[model samples]
Target chain A: GAGVSQSPSNKVTEKGKDVELRCDPISGHTALYWYRQRLGQGLEFLIYFQGNSAPDKSGLPSDRFSAERTGESVSTLTIQRTQQEDSAVYLCASSFFRGVQETQYFGPGTRLLVL
Target chain B: DQQVKQNSPSLSVQEGRISILNCDYTNSMFDYFLWYKKYPAEGPTFLISISSIKDKNEDGRFTVFLNKSAKHLSLHIVPSQPGDSAVYFCAASARVFGNEKLTFGTGTRLTIIP
Candidate 1:
């Protein structure tokens, strides 16, 4: 089976520009998640969607960050007015069922660099 | 606050030797833990996971040991192969309703010297 996939494996944007990262989850996955990984730092939760609706947007660092998922497949993480702090790998993951121990499959990630 | 922590930034081991990676968490509510392996420019692949009910879980040459009292867990790879060289991340989460939010560690880069 094909695993989760992400597009634009790498992106370089100037400060103040907006960038959108895309994620394609596996078929039948009902839950989708977005996370950010800064250099020398851990993964930070961004937003999560279940069946096309996001229930937890608390992790969004600021109002400039947003994400949307269509049904259970593709998702997009948009960062508005990019800053140097946003230069990092944006990861996407999906799980079959939403639970405390559901196994998650991850995408290759989009590495964004703000210049 | 950073809940999950991986103190060591990198580790090196000889081929066929054992590689140990440590992870610690401060969140007492988290009961599920997972370990992921990532290659350069690739997404993290699920390696193994342990629930709060169990103290240890093993898969092939990879073993994950958890100590609830200490809120610590470690992954051990025996007879490590060159293919196992990659960044290892430890993540934990507690489920609420159907959505579970995960907190990850800084990750440890493992290099196997063949």
Candidate 2:
């Protein structure tokens, strides 16, 4: 079975530009998540979507960051007015459901560079 | 503050030897612990997990041991193989309603020598 997958493996954008990263979760998965990993750091939770419930936006670092998932399928993470601090690898993951013990399968991730 | 911490940034172990990675957490609310392995240009894959109810969980050559009192956990790989060389991340999650997000550590790079 195909695992979670992200598009545009790499992206380069100038400061103040906007970038959208896409994620395709595994089929039948009802839970999707977005995370960011900075250089020499760990993965930071960004946002989460479970089934049709309201998305968890608590992890979004700033107002410029947002995500949307339609009908438990594809999801897009948009970062408006990109900043050098936003340069990092954006990863997506999905699970069968939003359970405490459920395993999250991750994607290859999209590396974004802001200059 | 980092809820999960892998004190060691890197470790090197000889093939056929035991490899142990350590992690600590400040939040006692964490009831589940997991280990993930990742290779260059790849996403992390789940290795093993341990629940708070039990102290240790083993799968094949991977075993995870947790200490609720000390808020510490360790991953042990027996007879480590060269192919096991990669970055290992420690993650934890509390069973809070409507909050299933995992908190991850900075990760430790492991190098296995053959």
Q: Which candidate is the best by lDDT?
A: 2
**Which is the leading candidate under DockQ?**
2
lDDT of each: 0.90, 0.91
Q: In angstroms, how far off is A76's CA in candidate 1?
A: 1.3
**Quality class of the docking in candidate 2, CAPRI style:** high
lDDT digits (tens) for residues A17-78 of candidate 1:
99999999988989888988888887888888888999899889999998898756789899
Report iRMS values in order. 0.9, 0.9
Off by over 4 Å in 1: A98-100
lDDT of 1 by residue, B7-112 (tens): 9999999999999999999989888999999888888899999999999999999999999999999999998999999999999988643477688998999999
Candidate 2 lDDT by residue in tens digits, B71-91: 999999998999999999999
Instruction: Give a tens-digit lDDT track for model 2, residues A24-110.
Output: 999998888898999999999989888745468888999999888888799999999999999999999888864557888899999
Off by over 4 Å in 2: A98-100
